[model samples]
Target chain A: MRALVVEDYHPLRAAIAQALRGEGFAVDESGDGEEGAWFARGTPFDIIILDLGLPKLDGLEVLRQMRARGDQAHVLIVTARDRVEDRCAGLDAGADDYLVKPFAVPELLSRVRALLRRAYARKDPVLRIADLAIDTATHRVQRGSQDIELSQREYTLLEFLALRAGELVTREDIRSHLYDFRSESGSNVIDVYIGYLRKKIERDDLPRLLTTRRGHGYILGPA
Target chain B: MRSLRWRIALAGGALAALMVLAGGAGLAFYLQHTGEQRLRVLAASQLQALAHGLEFEHGGIELHSLPESGLGWALYKHDGSLLAGSAWPGMAPPGSKLAAPAVTRITTPEGQAGMLASGWFQPDEDDRTGGGEISASLVFSTADIDREQTGLLLSCLAVSVLTASLAALLLAAVLRHMLRPHTDLAEKIAALEPQCRGQRISTATLPAELVPVAERINGLCDRLEQSYQLAATFHAAAAHELRNPLAGLRATIEVAAGPGGDPASALATCHQIVRRMEARVANLLLAARLDAGQVEVRRDEVDVNDLLVQAWEAQATRAADRGLEALWDLQGSGIASADPEAVRMLLANLIDNAISHADRPGAVRLQATTTDSWVTVEITNPSSLDGERAARLVERGRRGASTSSDARHAGLGMGVCCGLAELLKGRFSVSADGRELRAVLTLPEAAEFTYW
Candidate 1:
C-alpha cells in the first residue's frame, strides 16, 4: 500500500507523487538516485516508480544495489528515454515494469493497482471475502447485494486490511502506508480512519469481515 | 565537333605536315637549281670548244660539234646572222642578242621545258687555235629532270600525310591514357555523399599527380562529417532539453485542471513552469549562438568589484529564500576589457550553480582577486560533488547530484558559464572535494579605466 517515486524533474515528480497519493497508496518521493535507492533499500514499500537518468547515481545502479541487497520491492521505470536500448537496460537491471514519460495518470494508477494485486497474490481485481466484494480497480465495495460507499481515507484503510486478510497488521505499518514524509505523525489518525471504514462495510446481515486483535493490531476476513 | 582528344590529335598532325612540306620544298628547289646549273655549264663549254677550233679558217668559225650532248648550240654574228650552229625550235628566238652569259628555263618546240645558256664567248686570246668572240646560245631539254622533281614532291606529300595520320592516332591514345585519372576521380567524387559521414575514397590507387585532389576531397569529407555530427548533437540536446519542460507543462496542467485540484495552487505551478521554460530557452539560445560564433562581444572598461557585488546580490537573495547562507569576499579591485552584460551573465551562471548545488542549509562563498595582469573570480559551495563529478559539470546537459533544486533540467548554468568565459577570452575551470565544489574564472586585466 506504500509507493516510492524516484523522478528528478520537479513538476513531473510532484505530479506523479500526487497521482499516486490520490490513488490511495501512501507515496514518498525523491529527486535523486542515491536517496531513492536508500529509501528503497530501507523501507518495505510495495512498489517503486524509478527514473533511469538520476543524479548522484544512475537509476539502474540504484536498482542493482537494491536487488543485490535482496530487497524485492516491485520497481516501475518511468522516464523520457524511451529508446529500445534504454528500456532494455532498465528492465534488465531489475525493474518490474516500464512506463515512458507523459504517461496517462489513469493508466499509471491501473498498473499500480495490478502490481499491488500481484503482491497480495490475488489474481482477481476484486478482493472478496464471503458475500463482501471490493473492486480494487474502481474502488467500489458491496456486501450481500448491498452497495457500500466510503471516503477516500476509509477506502484505503479497508483495502490495505483486505489485501492482507487472515493476518494481523501493525499500527506502524498502517501509518507508514497511509501517509507521506511531510505529514505529521498524529498516531491516532489510522484508528479513526478504521472506525469510518468499519461502519460502511459491516452490515447486520453480512458475516463479519473486519476485526481487531487485542494487544497487537487489526485483521480482516476469516481468521 | 571534334572531341578534346581528337582536336589534340589534329593539331599534332597539322604541325607535322607543315614541317615536312617546308623541308621537302627546300631540298627540291636546291636540286632543281643545281641540275639547271650543270646543264648551263655543259652548253657554255661546248660553245667554247667550238670557238677554240676556229682559226678564222674559211673566214668563219668551224668546229667539232661533239655529237650534241643532248644540247643544241648556235652561234650568231653581231649583225644577227648565224655563223655556224644547229638550231632547235622554240630555242630563245635566234636574233636575241646574248651580250653576257645567262641560264634560263625555256620551253622547247616540243613543249617540254629546257635550260638555255646564252653568252658571247671569246677564247682565251692566246695559244693554239686563237678564237674570236661570238654570240651563241645552248638549249638543253629539262623534261626528265622536271619529271623527277615532280615525283620527289609527290613522294614528300605522301610521306607527310601518312606520318601525320600515324602521329595523330598515337597522340589520341596517349591523351586518353593520360587523362584516365580525371575520369576515375570524377566518378569517385560523384559517389560521395554531401554529408559523407565515414566512407573515404581510396587515394592509393589514384595517379600520383591526382593524389592531392583526392586528399583534398577526403579532407572536405572530414569537415562535412564533423559538421553533421555537430548538428545531430545539437538537435538531440535541444530535444532532451525541451522534453522536460514540455512534460512539466503538460503534467502540471493536467493535475491542476482535474476535479480534485485547487485552482490557486494550479495557477502558481503554471507560472513557475513558464518561468523555468523561459530561462531554459534563453540559456540554450545563448549557448547556440556562442557555439556558432554568432555572438559578438563589445569590450568596455568594467569594474570587477562592482560586477562581483552585483552578481552576489542576485545569488544571495535566492539562497536566503531557500534558508541557506551566502558569503562574499571582495578584494583587489581591478578592471577587465570585456562586455559588461556578458560578464554579468557569466557571474550569474556561476553564482546560480553554486547556490543551487550548495548543501540544503550550507554556506556558499564568492571571492575575487586581481594580480598585475590577471583578474580572477571563484565561487565555492558545500556539495556532494567530487572531483570526477565536478569535471563533467560543464558538459552540455550534464547535471550533478544535488537535489536541493531540480537537477533534471540542470547543467545549463554550467554550460552558460563555460561558454561565456570562452567568449570573454578567459578560462573557466572547476575543482571539487568531498565537501566542496569550486568554480574559477581567470581573465586578462583591462588597461583602460573609466571611473563612475
Candidate 2:
C-alpha cells in the first residue's frame, strides 16, 4: 500500500512517515500544503494524511482542489484542531477519517489500514482467495495449514493483488503502489518481486493461486 | 416611585389634584360673595317700595299694599321709634336713629338669617308725617342664599374630588402607555443570553427616545463578542502550539519502541521536544504575568555585551543547523540598569527569532551601543517578510508566512520579548527594510538609575 503524509511539523511528519513505512507502506511526505497538493494530484496514493494548518495553501483548500480534480484517494485528516466543528468540517470536505494531533501512532496506523480496506471495498481485515488467507492487520499470510513468511516488499505487493483478487492488475499499478517517488523505477522489478512471492506462497501440493495473463498483467486467483 | 412609570404618574396626579382644589375654592368664594350682594339689593328695593307706599290718612302711616310675605318691613320716625309696619327685632332698635340708607345682616323674629335696609324717606305729599320724612326698614330673609351657598360648596367639593380621581387615573394610564417601550427594553435586556452570538435588543420596535440606549447596549454586546472570539482564538493557538510537540513526542516514542528502532536518537529528540514545549509554556506564563502586571522588577547592573553573547551562543546550534552566520559589533560600555533575568529573556527571544527566521545561507547582525544615559541593542537579519508582516510580527499569536517551516516556534517569542522590554522599562520596536528585518531594544544606562 502507498500513502502520502502532508503535515507541517518536521518531527511529527518524519515520525508518521517512518511508522507507515515500517508497516509495509510506500510513504511519501510533504511539509507544506502546496507540495502535498501537487503530490496528491500527480500520484495515485491509496491514503493521504493531511493537516489543516499548512503554509502556502490551507489543507481544506487542497482537499477541495483534489476532489474538484476528481482524485478519489481516501483522505485521513491529522491535525491539532480538535474542535467538533473542525472535525465536522474536515469530514464534510472529502475526508475519509479525522484524527486529531497527539493521537496514538497505533491508532493512526489502524485507521490508515481501515481506509485502505474501504478503498478496496473490503470490510474484513483479512483477504481470502480459496485457501490462501492474507491478514492485512498483521501483514501475515497462510495457505491451508501452512504458515508463510514474506519480506515487507513482497507482502505489500501480495496484499495489493489480494485486495483485487480475481481481477487483472497491471504492472504500472504495482509500480505506483509499491514504490514511492524516491525509489528507482526499474523495468522487470514487478516480475522479479512476483517471482519471489510465487516461490514463497506457491507449493507443488496446492493449486496455483497466482497467474499471469500473456502481455497483460497478473491476477491473484484461478484463471 | 422606585419605578419610573409610577413616579411620573404620581407626580402628574398630585399636580392635577392641587389645581382642582384651588379652582374649587375660588369658585365657592365668588359664588358666596355674589349671593350676598344679590340679597342686599333685594332688601334695598323692598325698603324703598315700603316708603313709597306710606300714607298719613289716619294717625299712623300704612303701606300702600302688603309687602312680600318673606319681607319684614317697619316704618320708623326720625327719632328711631317704630311706627306702623313690623320688622325684625334688630331692624329698628329704640335708641338707634335712622339717618341714612344702610344694609346690615340681622336676625328675624323667627330667628331666620336676613339682610335689613333702613333709611329716611319722604311720605306722600298729602299724608305727610311730622317733618315729611319717614324712616323705613325692610328685612330680607337670607335662608335661601345660605341653602344655595351650602349646596354650591358641597357640589364644588364633590366635583373637585371626582375630577382629581379621574385626573389621577388618566395621568397614570397615559404615563404607562408612554413608558411601555422602556418596559419592553428592560425585559429584553434581562432575557439576553451572553453566550448567544448576534443576540441583540431590537431597536426597530423601540421609541425614538430609547433607540440610542438600545444601540449602545448592542454596541457593547458586539464588543463582548469580539473579546470572546479573541480569547477563543488565543486558546486554540495555545493548544495547537502545545499539541504539535506532544504529537511529535508520541510519534517518536512509538517509532523508537518498534523493532530495530534507535532509542538513543529518540531520547534526544524527545528531550528537545520537551524543552521546546517548556519554553512555549514559559512564554505563555510570562505573557499572562505581564498582562496582569504581576511580574516583579529588580534594578541590577547588567552587561548588554555579555547578554548578547550568551543569547547568541545558546542559539548557535540552531543557527548553524539552519546555515545562518552571526556577526556582532559592540561599542562603548554596553551596561544598563535593568532586571538581569528580564534582559536575558528579552535578548534570548530576540536572538532566537533572528536565527529561526533568518534566511538560510545568510547572516544575522547584532550591534550594541551605549549613549550617555541609555544602552541600545539592535539585531538585524535577512528575512523575506514584507513590511506589513514585520510590523505585526510582535503581535501576540501572529506567525510568519512560513509557519510550517519552523515547528519549534510558537509565534510567542517576539511578543514575550516586547512584554519583557516593557517590564524592564525599555523600548522595543521592529522594522522591515527591503529584505532585512531589524529589532531594537533601548534601556536606561546604569548611571541613570537609582537603587530600587
Candidate 3:
C-alpha cells in the first residue's frame, strides 16, 4: 500500500515516514500544507497522514480542498492539540481517524491498518477466496494449508489484487498503489511483480486463482 | 448606613419627622391664639351687659341684677370708688380706674387666671340720678381654656408622633421599591462565573443612573476574556513546541528498539531532542521569572567581549553545520557593569537565534562598542523574516514564519533575551529591513572601567 505524510517538524516527520516505510508501505512525504495539498491532488494515495499546524496553508483547509476535489483517500490527523473541541473539529472535518502527538508507533500502525481495511470495505483482517487464504495482518498467504512465501513487492501487489477479488484491477491501479512518487520503476514492474506472485501462489494441484483478460487487467479469484 | 437603601430611608424619615414637628408646633400656637381671642370677646360682652344694668340713683350706681353668666362683674363710679362687683377686690389693684374700653389677661390676688375687660359708660337720662359716668369691669376665668389648651397640645403631640412613625415606615418601603434595580444588578454581578467568557451585565433593563456602572463592568469583563484567550493561546503554543520533540524522541526510541535499528544514531537523535526541549523549558522558566520579578540580578563587572566569544564558540558547531560564518567587530572596551550570568545567557540566546535563522552561506555580523558608561552589542544576520514578524520578535511565544520547520527553536529565546537584558538594567530592540534582521542590546558599563 502507498501513503503520504504531511508534517512540518523534521524529526517527527522523518520518524513517521521511516516507521511506515518499514511496514512495507510506499510512502511520500511533504514538509508543508501547500506541498502536501499539491501531492494529494496529483497522486492517488490510499492514506494521508496529516498534521494540523502547517505553514503557507492550514491542514484543515488542505483537507477541505482535497475533499472538494473528490479525493477519496482516508485521512488520519496527528497533532498536538489535545482539547476535546480540537478533536471534534478534526473528526468533523472529514478525517477518518485522529491521533494526538507522542503516540506510540504501534498504535499508529494499527490505526493505519484499520483505515486500509475500511478503505477496501472489508471487516476481517484475512481475505478468503475459495480455498486460498491471505492473512493481511501478518502479510502471509496459504493455499489449501500449503504455506507460500513472497517478496515484499510481490506481497504488496498480491494484496492489492486480493483486496479486489473477482474484480478486474488494471495495471495503472497496481502501479499507483504498489509504488510511491519516488519509485523509478518502469511500466512493466507491475507485470514483473505479478508474475513473481503467481509463481509462488499458484500450483498444479490447485485450480488457477490468478487470471488475466486480454489487454485489460488481472483478477485474483476463480477463473 | 452602609446599605444604600437604608441610608436613603433613614434620611427621608428624619426629614419627614422634622417637617411634622414644625407643622405641629405652628398648629398648636394658632389654636392657643384663637382660644384666647374667643375668651377676650366673651369678657368684653359681659362687661358691656354689666354697665348697661347699672341704675344710678342719688349719685350712686347699683346693678339691678347680675347676669347668670360664668363671669365676675363689678360697677365702679368714675372716681375709682367702690363698685357693685363680685370679684373686683381680687380682680385688680385697688383704686385702678378705667379710662376706656380695654381687655387684658390678669392673675387675680386669689390666684385665679382670667381675662378682664373694663369700660366707662354714661348713664341715660331716664336712669340717671345725676350726670356722671359709670365704670364696670368683668373677669372671666381661663381655667377651662388652659385645660383645653393642654388637651389640644397632648392630642397634637400624639398625632405628630403617629404621623412621623407612619411616615418613616412608608418612606422606607417606597425607597426599597425604587432601588430594586440596584439590588438586581448586585445579584447579577455576583452570579457571574469567571470561566464563562463573554458573559456580560445587561444594561438594557437598568436605570439610567446605573448604566455607566454596568458598562464599565462589562468593559472589565471584555478585557478579562481577552487576557484568558491570550493565556490559552500561549499555553497551546508552548505545548505544541514541547510535545513535537517528545513525540520525535519517543518515535526514535521505538524505531531503535526494533530489528536492524541503529542504537547510536537513535541515541544521538534522542539526546538532541532532549537538549532542545531543555533549552525551550529553560527559556520559558526565565521568562516567567522575569515577569514575576523573581530573578535576582547582580552588578558585577562583566567582560562583554569574553561573554560574546564564549556564546559564539558554544554555537559554532551549529553555525558550521548550517554552512554559515560569523563576522566579529568587537571594538568596545569589553566591559559592562551587569550580571555575568545574565549577560552570558543573553548572548547565548542571541547567537543561537542568529545561527538558527541566518541564511546558509551567509555571514552573521556581531559588533560591540562603548559610549560613555554604556556598552552596546548588535547582532545582524541575513534573515527572511518580514518587517511584521520582526517587529513582534520579542513577544512571548511569537515565532517567525519559517520556524515551523525547526523544532529546536520554540520562539522563546528572543523574549527571554529581552527580559534578561531588562533585568540587567539594559535595553533590547530588534529591527528588520526585509532582507536582514538586527538586534541591539545596551547595558551599563562598570564605573571604574570608564577610565581604562
DockQ, computed on Cα atoms, for candidate 2: 0.48
lDDT of 1 at B336: 81
Q: What are the lDDT figures for the candidates, one per model?
A: 0.74, 0.82, 0.80
- In candidate 3 the C-alpha lDDT for residue B136 amounts to 68
Query: Each model's DockQ?
Result: 0.25, 0.48, 0.37
* Candidate with the larger lDDT of 1 and 3: 3
lDDT of 1 by residue, A75-192 (tens): 8887767668878988898888888776777777778888888888989999898777889888898887888988877888888888888789989888877776777757678777
Instruction: Rate residue B235 of model 3 by lDDT.
Output: 74
Instruction: Kindly give the stretch of ten consecutive residues in candidate 3 chain B with the minimal lDDT sum.
Output: B399-408
Instruction: Order candidates by TM-score, high to low.
Output: 2, 3, 1
lDDT of 3 at A117: 92
Deviation (Å) of B231 in candidate 3:
3.1
TM-score, cand. 2: 0.81
Which has the better TM-score: candidate 2, or candidate 3? 2
Residue B346 displacement in candidate 1 (angstroms):
1.4
User: Which candidate comes out best when scored by lDDT?
Assistant: 2
